[model samples]
Each structure stands twice: as C-alpha cells, then as structure tokens.
Target chain A: MADAAAAPNADQYEEQHVHEVYEQIASHFSSTRYQAWPIVKSFMQELEPGTIGLDVGCGNGKYLAVNKDVFIVGSDRSSNLVKIAAQHEPHSAIIADSLVLPHQPGRFDFAICIAVIHHLSTPQRRQEAVKVILECLRDDGRALIYVWALEQKNSRRGWDEGDDQDVMVPWVLKTGKKNPMEDGATEKTFQRYYHLYRSGELEADVNAVGGGVVDSGYEKDNWWAICCKSESFTKASG
Target chain B: MKVLTLNFLTCAVKACKSTSTSFPLHPKDCEMVSDTIEPNPKLLYNILPRVNWTALLTTVAELGFPELPPNPPTIEELQADEKMTQELHTLLLETQISEGCLVCGNCGHAYAIKEGIANFLLPNHLV
Candidate 1:
C-alpha cells in the first residue's frame, strides 16, 4: 500500500519523459541511427515480399527504408521523428503512441518493436506495451522486440550501480551537433527514462501479457525476443 | 506506396475500423509508375504465398494496370516459368503509387497520397 502511494503513475511518467527526451533529441538521434542493427536487417530480409509490416516506435524509419521489398507502415509518438521518418519511408508514417496503435487488430503479418519498450517506466506498462504489440499482429504473424539489457560490459549498464531496475539514462548532445534542418546550431544534453531488463525479465513480462515468446536471447547488450499471438489467445480474443 | 502494400492498407475511418471491414481500401484516381530491376525468380516465387490475391487483383485493376492475370498463378506454375515470376516481381516491388486518394469502402474517407506519402491524418471532428 505504501509502495502504491509512493509511486507516481508509471505510464504517465513514461508518457511525459519519453516524448520530451525524444522530441529534444529527435534531430541528433536520427543522425546516429542510420544503420539497422544486423540482427534486425536479417529478420526483415528473410520475410517474403508483399508482407504487411508494421514498425512500432519506428524511430527515423530505418526499418521502413532498408526493407523496401515489403511495404511497412511506420509509427512513432514524436511528430518530429515521424516527419524525419516520412522523408525516408515511401508510404504512410503516422504519429501514434505505442500504447494505442493506429491500425486495426490482425492487420500485420510482420511487426517489430525495436529499441522501444525499455523506455517504458514501469513493469506493468512494459507488459502492456508487449501485449499491445502482439495484438497488432495476426494470429500467424511474428514480432521482433528488443530492449536494453542490464548486462553492459563497461561502466554499470543501467543506472548508478544499485538494485533499482528503473532509472533515467541521459543522452549527451555534443555541443554544435550538426543541425540537419538548419545550419550551425548546437544541441544540449538530455536524460531519458529506461527500465533495463535483466535476462528472462522480457520473456516473463511478455508471457504475463498473454504474448507467446517463440525465441528469446541476449544479443550484445540487448535482450531480444521474437513473439507471436498464441493460438489459444487468438481464439479468446476472437 | 507500392500496390502490394495497398493490399494491407485500408480505410482507417471511424466506421470500418476493424480487421473485417476496413481492409483493402480502394485506390481511387491513383497514378503509378513501374520500375525495372534484376529478375529474382526465387524471391518472386517465395512472395507468392503472402499476396492477398483477390485484394491485390482488384486494387491493381483500380490503379489502371489491369495486366495481372484474372487468376493468381499456382506455386508450381510460378516455379516453372521464370518470366511470369519476374513480371510479378515488377508488379509487387517495382510499381509505385506516386499520387492519388484511397477511398474507404465503409465510411467514404479518401486518404490522399501525394509524392508517395499517404496522409492518414484525420480531421478534428473525426478525432
């Protein structure tokens, strides 16, 4: 009871911080996020052409641009990121929150929520994001989701060396970072909310949300998992 | 937007806002261009399984490229004829919808596509 009273609404905190951090860093974020992680590229490349794809939290639309053979609809909460993504993605890129996706249920055979879920502040909210992602997929569809793992090699990976799972990670915007839209404007440092996953935490939370984790493992410093809407859950939803 | 992507896109209007009713939005007054690329018959053959044949056929016809066979090619037929597979490659990947409006079958919302960008933005009243 004390814990409940002490904690601010997790989703609301995430909603406020995530948007602010991204909006401020949208320009700098796009410049560095040029290449798709090799794992992500391989996953999309394997899909057949004409597959219906959705890139949830599609920051700067890297997946949409690289995997041109399949038509992918892109979405992001930040309007600035969506606009930048629209420049590369040849189709629809809309402003949408990850919690409430824009498309109908079962509309996508292929979906990816990459580098997005770790931004959610609370455990329950993270699980809900995973559930919402699965709901976006058809019963036969597949999803690839990645979150930052607690096991980074260098300095303590998540937060200042402690038992706390939730922490705010800061992004340092180098002074005089090349401004894309305008010339010679410097950017400032910013901190973003993150809930770093520890090993099976991702798979467990997803499973709790009725999402079936087909494959899960650590890739580099991230906990990556592939999921699908299970048959039983599909029938129940139907 | 590619014609194949149109297979998935549908009217996002308020009324037909579900998997059952909103899908395969009609591409009305769409202008398109077809590009040529190296023929990858294997890729084309693999793509055969996922194409929503009826939706694609109707959508492509509406886009003024009524060249696809009335019936989709069987897997065996596609594997046997590389040229047919290559043609399908052109249809699915190369064709681009540069300008037009996608009309919703359920609620009469026309999503405009200008310079290859589909505007899914809804008016304030709709929101």
Candidate 2:
C-alpha cells in the first residue's frame, strides 16, 4: 500500500488514479454507458461482416455487439469493464493499456475508440493514445475515435466546459441508502482526470498522425473523427 | 480463454513490440469451463477467412482441447458440417479460461486469468 503511493511519475499517477476511478465506477459507468452512440453504431454497421476489428478503450463493450458480423476484440484498462465485456463476447475483452495494445500491427480492418482519449491527462499522452490506436490497424484500416468536446452547450449535466482544457471532473455516486437531509450536503465526489479538447485538437492529432482524418466534426458535445492508415495519406501528411 | 481468441493476443508488456509473436501464451494449469452459446454457423463461415487457421489449430492443441483440423474447412465445407462449426463455436466461445496463466512463449511473462477475467496488466518494470 505504501509502495503504490511512494512514487509515480505524471503518466503513472494519471494511470493509477484513472484505474481507481474505473474500478470504483465500473457498474455505474456501465449503467449509463449501456448504448453505443448513433454515429459509432453507423460506423460499425458499415463494416463488412468478416472484418476483424478492435474496440480500443472499450467500456462495457456495448459496441462490441453492434455488428454481430464483425468479430471485435475489446480491450480496456479496467479489469471490471473487461469482465463485463467478456460476459458477452467470451474471450473478447482484455485488461490492457491503450498506449500498448497487445496485438499485432495491421491485424484489424477497423477499430472503434469512443469516449476514451479524453481521459489522458497530457497532450503527449493524448498523442500516444491516438498513435497506439492507429498502430493497431492495417495500412488501409480505419478507426472511429471519440473524445469529449469543450463546446458542451447541449449537455444536460451543464458540465462547465471551462476555458481551461485540462481539468478534473467529479462523479457523484448514489449510495442507494438515503440519509435524512440534515442540511444541503454534497455527496462524495470521485475525481476523474480529463483533458478537454477544442474543435481542431482532435483534427490536428489525426493530421499529425499524417492526414489520417477522413472526416471530423463536433456532435453532442464530443469530437467524432474517422481516421485511416492510408498509404497515400501517410505519404502526403509525412 | 478460447484458443482462437489467443490468436489475436500478445503479452501486454509495454516493452513487447507489435512485431513480436505474442500468441501461444502458454496456459499452465488452465481450468476450463463449458458454456452454451447459440451456434451460428454462418458467423463461423465468415470468420474462417480472416483467421490464421494454423495458429488457431496449434494454440487449441496447446490448450489441451480436442484438436481442430490442421486446415480450416472451406466455406462450403464449413456450411455443410454443422457439427464441426458448432464444435468450433463451443471451443472458441463456450470454453472459458476460468483461471490460469497465459505465459508468453518468447518473453516468459505470465498473464493471469482469474474468475474468467484475463489480467493483462504488467508491473512498472515490465512496462
């Protein structure tokens, strides 16, 4: 216990804290994340039946079942989420670091990484996460990635998409046992690190991976991007 | 875990690069459980084209399962043999690695599967 807190660099600190948040919130996260976003579903539906796919940062593996046609192997950092994912697609999900996916290059036809990259606490790490997803794909393979957007005007929670890009968001859990309201008291809040992105950040990162973005737009307070490892795109961007 | 599922996996250590052959993570004292999933022969027929037949065959045998054919059946062959398709489905989807270790062939890194979950997290030194 002391060793865990003894020393951790910026990356390790973020990793450790994120893991804790997910471990605690695994069930709550799944309850809210029961359905795949429409755009992501459309993307999954477009894939050919036999196409091999990877859902990097797959939380609860909702999209893994989107297209029964594609054999999607889901991977998440949290073992809890992986367990839920495995329940559906036996042996599909694995507890893995997104920056170091344990699979071969050019192994998948396409991939879906949703609401994942925004969790990285730094820009360099954000880049590395994006790089890892692209690295997992074939040269011609495509990936649909999503990140939380700063322009959250449409958000129901009224989350302050504040001016500062890097921030910590707190999630309040309902303990189910209602304590009498002695006073206006705040529920216990769990902090989750996030690096909120502006409009062009996701696009630039995709282009930084060398003009890999086929299409990118803001939808529902999130940045949605379609990236591919096209031989020509890489050459042109490089 | 199903042998065919192992085909796409590698040791999750950060040091292990993509070029490394991550498959055949040796399962030692593997506890297998049988599960029943509705068999869809059509899906199996579609999957064979993408899978590396030999890798799966070798891994399955290594995992101590009844040996699958050396070469995967052709589309027509798979469609005709419902029993074989169901068997493949059972092996891949129903047979769960309830608890065991998947040791990497090259790295000797042991990834543990406990209670049907595979813990692919590596320690700091390994990362």
Candidate 3:
C-alpha cells in the first residue's frame, strides 16, 4: 500500500486493499483471531448488566459471548464475518460499515472498536472513524479502541517507530488441495492495509475527534485506549 | 436479525439518523422464524427499559403480532408475571427475521435480510 497521505482515492484504495481482502479471508481470519486480548476481555466483563453496546468490526464475535448478561450488537463490513458472529447467542451481528453504522446516535452504553480503525486509509478517515464511534455513545458511554502499534519491534513484524505507518500486510490462506502442477498445497496471499499507530497516536486521534481518553495502555502488539465523548462535544451534539 | 436488534437499528444513511421516522425500520415481506431459546427474565427485564415502546408497537403490529399494551410493563410486573416474561422473551430474542427487507421509513432505503443477518451496507450514493 502507498503512504496514507499520498493516496488520492482513499475509499477506493481501502475498498480494494482492506474491504475486499477481508471479504476473501473472513473465515480464515476469524479462525486465527479466536484468542481474546486480556484488556478487551476485562473491558467487556466490567460493563454493568443490562447495558447495551456495539462491537464495531466484530469479526467472528468472539467477544460477544464473553458476557451474557449484557447485550451487544456486533457489526462488520464483511457479511461472512458477520455470519460467523451472528451465531453468538443473546447477541446479534449485522453487516454494516463502521463509518456509517445503522444504530441511532447517542444511545449505546458502551462500544468496542478493536483493530478496525487502522484499516482506514488516511489519518482523516481514521479520526472520522473514531468520531463516528464517539457519536454512537451516550453522555456517559465509553468506548474502547485498539490499533496495531508501530512500536512493536519485539514482535515478528518488527515495526519500529519512524517506520512507514501505512503498509500492506499479507495474509496467506492455505487451500487444502494437492496442486496438480506443484508439489505443495494451493495457497493465496491477500494484502490487507493497516496504519500502524505510533505511541500516543491512538489517544491523539481520539482527542482529534473530540473524545477524551479515560485510560490507555500498550498490550501485546497493539495500542489500546478507553475513551468517551468530551463534555463539550456531547453537550453540543445532544 | 432478531426483533430486539431491529429496535436499536435505523437507516444507515447519515441523513436519516436525525429523523424520527428512521428509528425502528419497518419490515416488509419479512419471513419470520421463532427459535427455541431458553427464557431469561432478567435479561428481558433489563432490556425492556431500553426498548422504545412506540417503535416496538409499530414493529409488532406490522409483523402481524397481537398489539401490546399502551405502555411497557414495569420490571416488577414483568418479574411477577411468568407469562409476560415468556412472551417478551419470545418477542425480543426468539423471533427473528429470516429473509426479507427492512425499509427505512425516512429514506425508504430497504436493507436486505438473508439467513437472519441484515445487510445495512448502503449504496455509494446513499453513503
């Protein structure tokens, strides 16, 4: 993928590099993302019973089953992913874009947009994504967000600070079939666009969208933040 | 999509969010299914307060279900009445739209439902 700032057609670029890739690898991707991150699990567990929330970009809905007492409506751009997610009982999943969610504004108790905003092709789009999430929240509603960290030198990708923030990460899908012309199984590589958030970047985006970061920390290879709409923004909109 | 989920959803169009008509999208030519889900009164009681009664009434009436009371039942009333609890549990959770369209009252944009999952993705012009 090209630099985020240089992409002239951000939506089209994302439609190809982000949306289409996820549509193709939804099942394979869902199988590998079954493990729940500790912070996200704790965030879901801490919510009060009867609270309603949205899981923006809920792939496979692994988190939807974490807490049965509360209800969560999960949405994903990929129908295949939403299909897998909809199977989680006591919760629901629908095919929806995070940027244009189908829910009414300022009604949710909480929301979690994990590893989804980074798929947006530009900083503006990323912040807009955050803005949309914040808009869905009530006055006291808080949202937790996670993005791939640029400071993951210890991880396999070794994306250090100052590296190109926007890059294409390849996901290799192994089709279990003996290739007639080759010696190994058939495989396909899909390149997915990601904007690696540098240290303090996630918080900055939240603030840029008039959201206040309640708490933030680095966990695993991702930067996570819990945020709420700023008082002024909420008042102005409400 | 479950009937309860539809209560929270509206037209995905940005312009439709501000309109009163968009909330509780109207189901058209919907094929309904009733799943044998275990009844949970606590969940139903907790969820009742959040549901917009007027919109839910409109939804049920459109779906050919019997008309509900003028107002939602109090949590205490719901807790005491087993039949009401079961009925609400059935209406909100068990009942789902298997296939059809959810047309937005404001924009008249119909989102398709297939295999119990509603596609809320709008066309490029709508977005």
Candidate 4:
C-alpha cells in the first residue's frame, strides 16, 4: 500500500526491474563500444582513498572497478543492475531506492547520484530525493550528482554542450511493462526539458541546504557537480 | 480525537529519543489530555505529507505539552524562526514511527502505528 506522503507518480524500481535493466546495459558495457569507462575513471580520480562511498544508480559497476580501494556501495533502482554490480564488484553493491535509502544515517562519506535525476518526472521529486541523499550523509560528507543538462541550441539531444541548458526532457508513462531487450519496447517520449543550471545554481542549492559545491562542470555530454555538507550549517544557532 | 496531536507527541518523543533526552510526557499522559487541546495550526504546515501531525499532536497533548502551535504558521514567521528548521529536520528526517499511527492531514484518517510503531499501511479504500 502506498503511504500518503509518497509521491503518486514516482515508481519504485524493485529488484526485478533493476536486474533486467542492468543485464541489458551490461551487454552493452561488455562490448567496449561506449566511452563510459574513461568518464568513470576521471570521476574516480577525485576521491579520497578509503572513503566510504555510495554509487546511486550505479549501472553494471563499471565505475567500481576503478575505485577498488574505496569502500563503494553501489545501489540501483533496477535489480538487474544491482545483480550485475554485485557480481562484478562483489565488495560493494545493493538494491535500493534513490529517493528513500534504506541505510542508516551518516553511513557514508561520499555519495554519487549519477545519471539518474533526469529520469524523474518532476522537480519536486528530484529535490526530495536530493534532500534524502543529504540526510544520508554525515555532516561532512560529499556527493557527486551527474545529470542531463540542457543540450546546445542547435545540437541533438545527446550532443555535448559546453554550457548547461534550461530544457529537460519530460517523463512518458509507459502503457505496459517494457521488455528490456526488445527493440521499441520502451519509447523515448520527451517532456519539457528542465532548465539546465546556470553555473552557480548547483552551488546555491547546496548552500541553501547547508552544503558547498566542491567541483562542477560538464564532461562527455553530461552535467556533473560535486558538493559537500557544510559544517557551519549543522552548528546549533545561538 | 484529532490525529495531529498524536503525531506531535510521537514526534516529540522521537526527537527526545534521538538526542537521548527524556521529554516530560509519559504513556499515562497519552490517555489523559487526548480530549482537551486543539491541534497546533503550525503543525499543518510543519507536519503535512511528512508527519501524521494530527495523531502526533493528539498524543503529545495527551501526554502533556498541550501548547503546540495551534495554527498553520505564516510564511514570514516560519522563515524567521531557526527552531522551525530544526524541528522540521527532526520531524521529516529523524522520526520513524513504525506502529503507532499515521494521521493524514488531507483525509484525516487515524492510521494505526501498532506496538510502538506507526504503520503507514494504506487501506483498500484507495484502490
């Protein structure tokens, strides 16, 4: 039964659905045809050694391989992805929600919610999910959120944009269950794209929530921002 | 009778528990004042969607702190108070009621949180 406070439109990616998505995405990774590995490598370079990290929506554990020294816990809405992640990176992986994490508070030093926020249909849900992630972190913990910023004015949907765009694709409710491997099983329906962040919006949101942006920029066709919880925000006010 | 009171009581109890501090209210208090106080109006804004405000307020007032904000707070008032931020953080992020009760603001349903737990169990009425 759905709780009264739970968002009606949000879909919980249970273990089964997650597995199917990962199994399909895994095959693509195995082919070595995509440039995803290098991007994951660059992301790993910025981490502190032995940091407890969470890879929210981590697909297939490709990034895990590069950060073997860090205690990385990979979570995905899709069970298929969780399975693949566990199989590939046995040291770290779990099936969990991006919006409502099952772990205890302050469990991690860093969290990476990459390539997931845009999939949500509404900004309210996205913000709530972000708030949940913030709660999951310790006072000094950090997060790296990579989202689909706006595409260049004349460029295609996936085209790389040097600057963030305001437009975001909308969510299209699927009429029926989608078969992961079948072509045209799911359609790419576009909703109004969210206005991509101007350079300071990421920092501003983090600041409002008592956090600070450590690093932010676009790379390899996606907008990436890293933020850390500010100690001053947690101090009891006089 | 109102659920918001119970929610506030539960929240206050949980908040007390989080910091390992004991509140003045007790279980016996839960039964005594359950009938007297009106739900805090500020609770509507503070507890909506996240808290079972009606139940919490009822329970706490029953336990004794009957002076909960009895009305929805103004935007200006909410912004001016730091306590609101702290309270909201605890109410939304800290309190985890597993079996006591879930009182909805919109529908005014007093869902049970049985056995020291607040059940968010949805009944068949919603389909």
Better of 1 and 2 by TM-score: 2
lDDT (Cα, tens digit) per residue for candidate 4, span A1-238: 2121233533432222223333444544334422453545666766655456677777666667665445566766555555566544213454455664534456466787866665553456566566666766766677788776554454465543464343334333343454432555554332332335444555565666666566677665566776766645344221
Candidate rank order under lDDT: 3, 2, 1, 4
The per-residue C-alpha lDDT of model 3 at residue A165 equals: 88
TM-scores, each model vs. reference: 0.73, 0.89, 0.95, 0.49
Question: In terms of DockQ, which candidate is strongest?
Answer: 3
Tens-place lDDT digits, model 2, residues A1-238: 1122233465677766677888878887788887778899889888876677898888899888777766778889888888888776532788888887777766778888899888876667788888878877877788898999877865863444556666667787555546422454535567887767787889788767663787778778889988877536544321
What tens digits encode model 3's per-residue C-alpha lDDT throughout A115-138? 999999888899999999999888
lDDT of 1 by residue, A1-238 (tens): 1122135776556656678789878888899998788778888888766567788898898887666556577878777787788665334466666766546678677798999988876667788888877877878788899988777756455333244566667787765545432445565557687777787898898789888777778776888988888736433321
Please give the lDDT score at residue B63 for candidate 3. 97
lDDT against true structure, model 3: 0.89
TM-score of chain A of each: 0.86, 0.86, 0.93, 0.67
Tell me the lDDT of model 4 at A212: 57
lDDT of 2 by residue, B83-104 (tens): 8777878877677788888888
Instruction: State the lDDT at A105 in candidate 2.
Output: 68
TM-score: model 2 vs. ground truth: 0.89
lDDT of model 1, residue A1: 10
